[model samples]
Target: MNRKKSIAHKLLDAIGLFEIHKLIAKHINQHHADIVVDYDLSLLRSAHLIGAPKIGFFHFRPKRFRNGGTNKLRRIGERLKHYQKLVVLCDEMYEEACFVWPHLKDKLLVLPNPVDLDSLLKKSACSIDFPENLTPGEYFVSVARLTHQKNIHLLLRSFAKARELGCKWSLAIIGDGEDRVDLLDLSKKLGLEEAVYFLGYQTNPHPYLAKAGGFVMSSREEGFPVSLLEGMALGCPIISLACPTGPTDILQNGKLGKLISFTEDNPDELGLAMFEISNNAALRKNYAEESKLFSQNFSSQKIAHQLMSLLRDIASNQRP
Candidate 1:
């Protein structure tokens, strides 16, 4: 089930809770399915109401839990004792979950998010025209939903400053979301109309990923950061905000990619980082080499093994 910090969120959850999941859980249970992997926490309550054992697959850092606020998260964390297991995307999240509900610590599993490297390679081979006035291997790319949590506003401002500081690369953002209008407005406000190219949503952005000279992520927070991992898989050097539960772990604290501290509304740190990453060819070379190795750890085979093992354990422990 979804958990939110504010009563307003709780009200919203109550209004639009799960009629679909409830029906699907019934079908799965009737068919003798032993477990439901809860990708979206919105369905956890329905899974249990149907008497199906669930493995909570955490895809985002729970805002209330990650930032250490409110009683709502504690209630949700305490409810973890009822789940078959909790699969977190990184060690920091695993620890955070344990801290949230110490008694359910044994039920927590650390599984790095996996990417389809082969699919990326396949898509990269496809022909796609670059945006007008764009050059391959001469710009920064970011792939994320244009939402408040992603903080695309921070990215535009940093890019503007980086431009002022003589960084020659342009920016291409992939994906669309609620913040698109606001972010585009900010881009123009910062006088970045020519330097930034908003590509909207692309079904296969691998061509952009492959040709990118570097990548940058300025999210306010994240759980796993799939975009950053995809960049590494394609051998594009990266710079990211040191958002909890992902970037620091993936970048090995700046050994493979640059991680800047998140300063509220101030793009100075990330702007400086962008300029440095653009100018340093040797560092970029080393980062590219190191990131290639780093990307291997999130292989589908490896993560699938862990997930399968959890499934077996849950199936075996069921009280028939």
Candidate 2:
């Protein structure tokens, strides 16, 4: 069945290495006396293995996969046991999931995920031209892989309802995933094919971010989403579902952007938010300014400095 193939592919992907990671690790190894890995950083384990210090990892929690069947976890644990130092970034803000893996509890650092803020900042300058018939400030945007976890369908329904209510704003979705076909069908069913534009996978999402009038996230759950950070950096006003562990914190409990209950499934709730951001230019401008300042902490330089500091600490204590 398809599920079997999916499992097989997951195994292979868990083992595959992207060329960029290889090049970076190879380059870093040349400088550092010994290299230690940060976990959940990538699916690829292409980092330096030659005379490297005991490899350490910074793991994400909330159980991306089961402990035994997950080859990625297995591989990471194998490395951790053999490596001199293993550090985990335990930003799996959902406390319920925290103690599930008792063995990993001691290693978890409880750190927030880091974003390549420099890249986002540089990309923020780029912009996309609005589609013909689409006017600036007349669109709401949600950039997320079309998937259940992201609740893209909820966004689509809300936007459709907003249209029905004569809000007249377009919703643009950027990113691709398994839920694409279902979402497209839902759009057609809701008569939103014209109003909802599905922009397939974008490797560099900055242009899309730049043109967007406002940003929205309707995730059911998340562990420090980078899209929110990228949106903040790009100065797009935001409206995110008040979800656990990520959005509320990033929004500073609705200070930076509107945070609503995940239980409110009515399109009107979502539509009202869309209307507020779309109609209120001042609020958008204020949000954009505040977001840019808030996003600085997660910038690449800051994260890289933190990583290097950890490296120094490990390198200093590492035994030959």
Candidate 3:
């Protein structure tokens, strides 16, 4: 009963939330001289239970429905007023949704999403074979869920155009979702069925990354793409839509890679850029170096230390 075990783990995780809340409450009580810390309130019932005058929200996603977001916002607003300190780690990784509820802006601390540098560096090699049918250096790699938000269609359209321009490039998309079938169909419709490969999800994509010549993203938006960071960390030349908050910041407003328009994208421009990058080995190497250097800012250890320092500062301020 693997399914039963999976179900059991889910049940345990759900139940453990209360235990974690209680433990945090206990710690707050024991350190009565300091502040309170609430992990995630979607599970915790009361702010008082966590016992901290200050709270840090990690990976907070505002609910979608109007009523839910409004209710959650009101609740958070109340807590913000009551709490001595309120900091939200709005890693804003997928903040396109936040465009709908712009009011949720001020509460965010905008921490960068962290990556384990050591682990990522360790995966600099790929084991997956370049199948006989595939041509080395003829494929572009994009690693993300096959979802509408990821704008897979734009990438497909761009690739199709690139192919029509006599550019020899295939696309290897790693990661799967409900959009897989539809995306496959879209590739076929665009006469790109043989040119694109959907490899589904891979727990370790570093191997694939190492063999890839470049990385691309057509997402409509993102806070900061971990995939982009990974590509940079692995020395793959990066390209992404000039989406909302993340990509531009990561690319330093096109300083790192080509940032194209999502609304009125010119495949001609994109294909030309790709064509140029394909031939320019020096430029590609330059981007690789830049990508690696840029990735250091998102290290997990650095974020953790910053978080600890912030917590200590809050705790000190809360000492009564």
Model 1, span 229-304: residue lDDT tens: 8889888999998887688888888888888886648988899889988898898888888898889878788878
User: Of the candidates numbered 1 and 2, which has the greater lDDT value?
Assistant: 1
lDDT: which is higher, 2 or 3? 2
Per-model TM-score on C-alpha atoms? 0.86, 0.73, 0.76
lDDT string for model 2 (1-320, tens) is 33367888766665554555567667667876565464654423443343466444443334553343456665655444444544443343535234444454444444456777666667766665547866656678788888888888889877776666677778888899999999999999999888888878876777667667888888877767778888888888889887654777788888888787764356668767877677788998999899889988777778778878877866787655
**Once model 2 is optimally superposed onto the true structure by TM-score, how far is the C-alpha of residue 106 displaced, in angstroms?**
4.0
Q: Can you give the lDDT of residue 291 in candidate 2?
A: 89
**Worst ten in a row by lDDT for model 3:** 58-67
Candidate 3 lDDT? 0.68
Q: C-alpha displacement of 41 in model 2, angstroms?
A: 8.1
Q: Model 3, residue 271: displacement in angstroms?
A: 4.2
Per-residue error (Å), model 2, residue 211: 2.4
Candidate 3: Cα lDDT at 301 = 90
List all candidate RMSDs to the true structure: 4.1, 6.0, 6.2
Question: For candidate 2, which ten residues in a row score worst on lDDT?
Answer: 41-50
Model 3 spans with C-alpha error above 4 angstroms: 1-45, 58-76, 79-108, 133-138, 264-272
